[model samples]
Target: MGSGRRNLKNAAVALLSPIPSIIFYLSLLNHCQRISSTASDGDHSLSLSPLWAWCYYHPLLLANVLFFVNVNVLFWVISHIQSSHWMIDLYWTVIPVMLVHYYATHPLAQYNWWRSKIAISLTWVWGVRLSHNYFRREKWQWGAREDWRFTDMRLQYGKHWWWVSFFAVYVSQQVFLIGVCLPLYVIHSVDEPLNIWDFVAIIACLCGIVVAFSADTQLHDFVSRNQKLKELGKPFVANLDEGLWRYSRHPNYFGEQLWWWGLVIFAWNLGQGWTFIGSFINTMCLAYVTKLVEEWMLKQDYRAEAYRLYQKTTSVWIPWFKSSIGGKDKKA
Candidate 1:
């Protein structure tokens, strides 16, 4: 989950506000130029919904706009029902499935079908793992818990949070998604056959997923063990600078950035090198987003000195840097 920061939310909105329109505009322009309302005979055999009849002229743009709209509306409704900020968190992982389905059923599906499937497959694997992690953290329950930052913002904004959240939290996040996933919107529809870039992209994407899965699993187990230890009236673990944590303070964040870069790679060779802005936007988000999360976390631990020492030794984002702050004796 993003763990919204009160100060950052407004800034994030300012920084990311332009992307959604750009994506929608580009999507509309791209599809309007090439796509048509009528598909060839074979596409008619697919058991697509009647909605496709309306989307005939601009299937990708239609899917793109519909998805972006549906998600924010759904999140708004869920937030009212549960008053939880993370109501939209799981959507981050799961929405790609629907995206893949939409593109796969498109007339362009007949173009680079297999390569697109590979991209979708990698997305599915990462999505499933990430969704499971969120659920395992018990975030799926409506009203069970609300992220602290949302609570803070609610107090800070008073009644304004009702409207502000609709834009800053929900809409802004969708803009980020639409921008970063633009390649997915662009790639499958093209009729190019598989190329070397596709293979390289698949491997890099899988590797990123593996890194993320491994890092998140490690953190989950560490937290779980510490919870049990606390329940048993024992001391909690001092530092988490173990495993991938040894290399990067936030390995999962790094891995996700890598994963999106891999997706960018998929479209890079198809005259889509310019698509990296999406990945760049996400990387910029991670740069301070993790710091916001850590601020909240540090409050929970109340171990400023230990965490500071840990921070000094460990690289903040990248891994395998030339520093060993690892004494293991000092508590983080």
Candidate 2:
């Protein structure tokens, strides 16, 4: 009976997981394309000049499509060889740099290199910090290195996990990544002088960077210190609900979400209102990650009760909502 139930669960997950979700999103993308197709191509071209002229000749679409396909192929191949789930993450840090660099490379936009520099430099900083954190945690391992959340899904879903990983974990994120990064393409296209949007982006970006960087550092330190205690015959602590964590259950996720949205402000200033989709999709992705992480925590040996209590009191996503403290249980 247990085996039969497992098979059923796996089968259900296979049919209903991220692929269908992404397909629905693709339909949305199609709708967006239809709506946007009515706009004149004259608008897509840089107003600056014809120097970086080729990007207007369908290069952006080609580059995006080709790069998107290549990354998914890498993810699909690497999924089978290494369960590490690192491939998706590696690109998170690496690709934004490429994207901004892509923006900066436009010869027509050379007059506005300052704006591109600001965006690209900020992105590079974020990428470096995040990738370094992952590296320090030794998550780059090749074999038997899947994220705990992914492993939980594998166990619950039974035998079809590889396919699920490809669809849900990998392929689904491609468009979202590019979409959330839409700001990168546009921020470099415009030649506007510094304005309120620039100030907003700068301030928000710094706040986000500090919050995320600090939160990760705190968590890392907490984990490291606890590991040392365990090695010295102390009990392993279950939660690190102090500092920024006291205010939010997922301060790290919160900060990162703000980080991308902050970057979107520049795109909005460029009259690329539709580019808001990029940041929104990424916010949804982060929320999903937060949910899965909490679920995974609940499944741990000594974590169920502690995290249940933590969940009762802590804000799930927002950074500092006082009302969330010691609040009633809210289901994920």
TM-score of each: 0.79, 0.75
Which candidate achieves the best lDDT against the true structure? 1
Candidate 2, which segments miss by more than 4 Å at Cα? 1-56, 107-111, 139-144, 156-159, 321-332
TM-score of 2: 0.75
Q: Candidate 1 on 1-332: residue-level lDDT in tens? A: 44445334533432343345446445544553343444455454243344444565566677656755656765576567656666566567766665765666555444477787787788789889887877777634322455666678889899899889888677777667777787787677676888898888888888888889899999989988998998999998766878998888899998888888988888886777888998888788778688787786677555666677777777787786535444444424
lDDT of 2 at 86: 48
- Candidate 2 per-residue lDDT, tens place, 1-332, comes to 76566445533432333243235334433544554466476453433234323433443564465455556665566556644564565557776776676556533334256787788889989899887876667533322144666767788877887778777776777777778788888887677887888889878887888888889989999899898998999887788888898788888888888888888888888778788888888788778788778877888868788788788777887876434443553322
TM-score of 1: 0.79
CA deviation > 4 Å runs, candidate 1: 1-54, 108-110, 139-143, 321-332
lDDT on C-alpha atoms for all candidate structures: 0.71, 0.69
